[model samples]
Target: MTESQRPRILIVENEPQASEILTRWLEAEGHECVLVSDVDEACQQLEQDGFSALLADIVIAEKSGIELVAKAKEHDPDVAIILVAPSEDHHKVIKLLKMGAYGSVMKPLDQDEVTITVAHAVERRRLLLDSRQTQQHVKEEIQARIARMGEREEHTILRLVWAAECRDEATGDHIRRIGLYSATLAEALGWDQQQVDDIRLAATMHDIGKIGIADGILLRAERLTSEEFAVLRRHTEMGARILAGSEVPMLQMARDIALCHHERWDGSGYSQGLAAEEIPESGRIVAIVDVYDALSHPRVYRPAHPEEEVTAIMADGRDKHFDPRIFDCFLEVKSKFQHIRKEVVPEGVPS
Candidate 1:
């Protein structure tokens, strides 16, 4: 990379006299030369060591020197190859160049011309290597920056979720359980790691729109009248609006979960009334987990239902309230769901 550094050259010539001449000329010019007689020796040297330029005679034993050019390239595509030969045919030279020979030197090699050509080829190789290293460094830096941005976005989302939880102390454990439950189901459903992680964080924000609802409706101990229930339903649309139009993948997933978590598989749920697969998979997944957690835990309007009763309630809604496949996956991992609920539910509180 530096001007003072000598270029390591691999000289492949069968004839001792020609090999000596090239070696002395290149060495005198301050380049380090490794002399090898045939293609086999050249390939061995190329594989064992790194070389900046390969200067090979056109005819090497029974094999053509053009073959060495390809072999050297295979060892290191950035290596420069110069063919030394007797033929002056333009077409032959073009063929060799197309085969990846950097340049050709005539049989009665002129010392000045050979030196200048090898010098140029070696310089070109050095530039290419430097450029590749620079590109790699830039790529690594970009990935690091993107990872940092993802971390920052996750932190911001968690803070907002916590702020929303402050509106109702009783719902704090509910939010945590929802995240764990969604992540576990997503993993069982064969979602990739990124999707599982995104859904975990995004699921926590499903009730974020409650922050915008008035305390009168959100904290009411009595069941809501039909007219008031409509206002409560608006929270879904409001949550979607709060999280919409983000470029972040997690936020986008959060928006979908927030908007459609209440939608039913039978097209009977509020807001969009999307049926079956018309709803985003994230929404469908959160819906089952949300309802299960709500039923298992005590709310102002009702006491916590027994686990048997909760299971029956969920089973009754199978195709009507939830996606069939998702409901099945939930059943398969229902035990894990119970474990997570017990682990995350706050102390002195019944789940």
Candidate 2:
């Protein structure tokens, strides 16, 4: 290698004669060298310079070469450190090699052999550094792709909700609000972040089954007869059916919320009539978020109620209509729900 192409090396040797010999060998081979007489100056030079290789004595000025090697690594983990020791201390040489010293130069240093060992050490460090950079680049690429997929999934879900609302009473804001309310309540329930995010998206589809109901029944502004009411209840089962048969995690959760949101805490609600603990928690959480949003917002058959009335109505259902624990969480964050309500209130509806 030419002088400009060779690795920059720092040589630590307390003996002036030995330091001169190392400098001559490396300079003869065109390797740029920084000569330090002891561990103190070696440490100082390491901090101030960028050296690709280090040729340090196993003991310099009564200090451990291990200390200098460790410090050099802290400055540049990929820096090659070669220890100089006597050949008879083979055990020590093995130990130092295990501690990350690239290699060792024997006491009877031959100029040609010293240059060869330094060259090998620098080449090994360069390969290790290249491998680490490649791994980091691959990791970053994987994260970016995952982020893109997540965005696409969210877009498809919102579009599906919008389509469902085209002929029903729900709005895009309504679905988004359901997701927000569910996430808040789930957080209070001690769910992990992934579970909370899943519920936030899944709860938005609680009324997706309304997509299958006839226009006369689903869009009616008047109270329904018992016959139409029974037909309306079918929306729950139909919603579960429509959302079933998928391995997609959020969709599976959406199916559960759709089917059981109408079920009561006391086993008196609709469709499956699951009692407390019998229903999935996803369904339980959406049940509270759905009814609160429904009663507080105007429905096709009723006017919007005040926040006080909404709470009173919900509180009445605590142990009967809703899960006790979840309902308690709802009470704590009811203000957030109201804030969402005001934020997305329909254009003509008064706050």
Candidate 3:
């Protein structure tokens, strides 16, 4: 390489004589060099300045050269690290390489071989940096596209929720509260951010099956007859089928919740009669929030129940209607549920 093309190398060595020899040899090869005698000084230089390649001794005072390699990579992931060790330290060389060192040089150092290795390491670092930059650019583009798609999906789901709301007597505020209630419960259950957000959106669609029901059945003001109730129960499976085969993860969760949210922990309540932990966790979570929101808000057949009565009703179903652990978690975050309902459902509103 020409002088202008020569790479800047940081050489970390404890021995003053060895450091001088290595620096002179690298400079003779037209490379810029920074010589530091210990890992601390080497780390300082790494943080304050940029270098194309790092040549560090296998042992520095109170620290292993492997430590320098890790620190250097953290400072500049593209920086290539070469360890200087004895020929008999073959195991150490192999270990360092596995830890992301570029290569190793054995002592007594051969100036020509070291120069060639450093040159190759510098070139390798350049290629890695280029590849990383390209990957980051592509990742940014993909995320941007996904963001736009997410917005469209969100709008479409809201429209579907609105359509379902129109069919049932539940107000728009009921759906909003369900979303918030479910999301809060999910977070309390230690779900990841994406899962929490997905539940927030998917929980609103738990009643979407009502869209498939006849208006006469969905809008009935009185108690449903045994036959009418049997038909109404099919809405769970109907909602599942409506949301089935969706490639979107949120919609997939929505489908599961729609299908199994009515299922009981003791194996007694649904289209499939799944019991205990057999139900999907998403379904279990939605089941609690769905019922809570329903009891707290008015329906065509009944007015909203008081919060105390609502809590007592839910408490009675802890082991049967709801997952025991989830019900306990709900008790912990019950205030958050009340806050969400109050914030979303305006005062004087039935919800």
Candidate 4:
């Protein structure tokens, strides 16, 4: 962040030395710090407004850190909380994180880890706020298009697409590619025109269940904790449930793609471990393109890899994460996929 945008951090630690250490570390990184020895001071400071994050001990002057976290969240749900605790308090840290703390820095803290964690927490806070603003803009635009499109089925599909795009990693460009790329692959596989058309629309809704995930978990800037990942993985099942029992052929295909897209060809995937041919053909097709689009785009944790690097990863996944025969077909139609990648508008830019 710029100097004008330095984070105003609230530090709640009872120990004088630890408090000083935190202040020095954070301030050296150009952050503005508010130091308090007890939860009461923290609460008072919190009431004054302008804290971008809360850095607190597991126990702050006889009060539980969890209380301060809750209070801070109430004040500003977007305020990132970084807990300071001993390794033995891993359970406490986990619970606090689940309660909306950004993350924790195990005590006897490593300077790099402390600084890095705080930086990441602060960045996440900013990104999530920015993303929410962007999503609102996107939603308004989507709603306008939906209103003009007319017809119940088209409206339902676009609304579901809106749900997926408004929340998670499904960018407008990403959604477009999923449909076109999946359709391209299906056509190359000698599928009938109807099959290709169904796969086109169905593939875009594969992650619609992401609407059910919390913004904090979905927008996290670092690797997720196991508990967090468990929560995230449920999007597949949730998507399936959302699309379930639709008598329409497209919705049925969508349900299958959502549920089984994450299942590995070698049986290492989740929600259910169907392997090889056991994974439905719909899931198999969407999985390859979903991964392709994801890897080709910049994500929260990493930048987008070049096409060659992305292709290498896909090649390595052959007969493992992807179906071998379909993989070969994708290679054959590689030029068409390249064209789709170029044709879509750049992600995060207004389209």
Candidate 5:
């Protein structure tokens, strides 16, 4: 449709005579108008149908005109809003402008004055709309680029995890199983899909820091001394350092998981000694899932623990090794955890 033919004015005034006068003046100026008498009706129309400008009265049926202006702006911030008030309503009108209104016109409205005011408001609204659209487009573009970059980073991190698994001669299933398990734990703990997926992607890369450890240390097939164990713990710190410096939420979250997943809930674990809520929620979540996955699988140092034993250990560790509320959620959906394991793991892999 032509720009001139666009719906340019919305009149939200309760007094029929007042609304009619303003509408007639705007129509005479060749602008389209949609007239509604109350804030509720005005907001509904504004949300459902787009408008370029708004002319509203300060008093509607149980609704303030200033409220209509605010709501209309929320629906379409670029829509010009010219509030109509009486001479006595000047204070209220000033308040409206402060609240993001475009302009104000006195009630004994002049047809010529109304026409000029609306034309100016419409132009301003057009500019605002254009600017907002451009900003939103730019934001979407940035997010899309970040997502692509995240995918590449995820692949690189996965390859690192695969390298560690390969050294142990373990199948790729180890990382895959841990990733899915962490996502399930996150979802049970009431995390959103983005957060759940972030944990899933991040958990798979948790052991990436182990690559920095010597193969002798990693594949020792025996317990390490206190000094050697200390050296091994630095992997968490190194992983955090490697994954740091990005503004991306997922990677930032991943870094936290790498750094703090070994931390005990009672402040007994880790390089930084972060305890409880000091740990990122994502990190706290992966801690439990990672340990559970390790125990349930046949690791280089230990045999696979039974599912029942795993659950008992988790329960025993609640509020010390894991977030208490998350542990509760895990217990509540314990059966579902097994189902996820069965779906994601083959018959040969320990559950």
Candidate 6:
């Protein structure tokens, strides 16, 4: 390459003689060279200077050059790293590549070979950097758009759940209470923060399919006939179908909860009749909270069951109607459950 065309390089080596030889040869070949004797100084110059590539000896003042390569990659993976080592240090050379070094040169130090190898590594680094930057930019934009769409979906689901509640005498507090109850159950079961949040938001929509039922049937003051009960049971399947094909995880959980919340642990549930662990974890969680909320809150037909009755019924359903392990978790947080119910009291509704 011509003097004006050759790329600049920073050579980091503690051996003064080796550093001088490398610098003089590189300069003669029309490349600019900056020599540094320590990793700290090399790092500072690498950060502040615009060099095309770095040629670093793997063993510098008792520090492994592989460590330097790893640290440099963390700072800027696009910066090419070439480790200079002895031929016998093949294991170290292999390790450097695994640590993200661009390439390696042996100690015999062929000046002509070094120049060509460095040029190739620099070109490869440039192309990779450009591609990575473009991918990052595209990923960021897509994530932002998905977030906005998710927010809109949440608002729509809230409005739909509220509309369904309009058919029954129960206020919006019932839904919000069930949401908090489910979230607490999930957290007690060792779910992470994101999973707990998803359960919270999604559980509020568990009764959304009730919107499809007629108001007279929904608000009947007396017990439903067997035939009417069968019709109402279809709400689980309807809710799942409404939310199917969504890419969002929270909506997906909501769909699962809607469909399987009525499912029994003993394989006696509806639709697909999935039982035990076959049920999605989200649905299992909602099942416990849904029943608890229904018992604690008054419906158009039945008055609220006492807290003792609610706890007794849940205990009975432990192995048959709900997951046994999650049931245990619920029992642990039963006291907090009532607190949440009180906290989510709907607008204009009495505590």
Clashes of 1: 0
Segments of candidate 5 deviating more than 4 angstroms: 1-157, 168-171, 347-351
Q: Candidate 4 — which pairs collide?
A: none
Best by TM-score: 2
Q: Model 5, poorest ten-residue lDDT window? A: 342-351
Candidate 5 global lDDT: 0.77
How well does model 3 score by local distance difference test?
A: 0.84
* lDDT digits (tens) for residues 209-320 of candidate 3: 8877887887887888999998899889998998999899998999999999999998998979999999999999988988998888776657999999999999999999
| Model 6 superposed RMSD (Cα) | 7.8
Greater lDDT among 3 and 5 belongs to 3
lDDT of 6 by residue, 130-191 (tens): 68778988999999999988677656655668767667665666766777788888888889
List model 5 lDDT by residue over 1-351, tens digit each: 123555568888878788778778778788888888777888898888778787778666225655676787777767787878888988877877888888878868877778888888877766676777889999999999999997787667666678655665445676777777788878877789988878878887776677677777767777899898988899898888878999978778878888988888888889788888998887787787777777787765578999999988778899988889877877787676677667757644332
RMSD of each: 4.8, 4.4, 6.5, 25.8, 7.6, 7.8
lDDT of 1 at 135: 97
Q: Candidate 5 vs candidate 6: which has greater TM-score?
A: 6
TM-score of every model versus the real structure: 0.78, 0.84, 0.64, 0.54, 0.55, 0.56
lDDT of 2 at 162: 69
- lDDT by residue (184-276, candidate 1, tens digit) is 999999999999999988999998877788888877778898888888898899999999999989889999999999999999997899999
lDDT of each: 0.85, 0.83, 0.84, 0.84, 0.77, 0.80
lDDT score of residue 345 within candidate 5: 71
Ranking of all predicted structures according to TM-score, beginning with the best and ending with the worst: 2, 1, 3, 6, 5, 4
Model 4 regions more than 4 Å off: 1-156, 344-351
lDDT of 4 by residue, 75-192 (tens): 7888888889999988878888887788888889789999999998888888877888889989999998876763455446655586566766566667767888999999999989
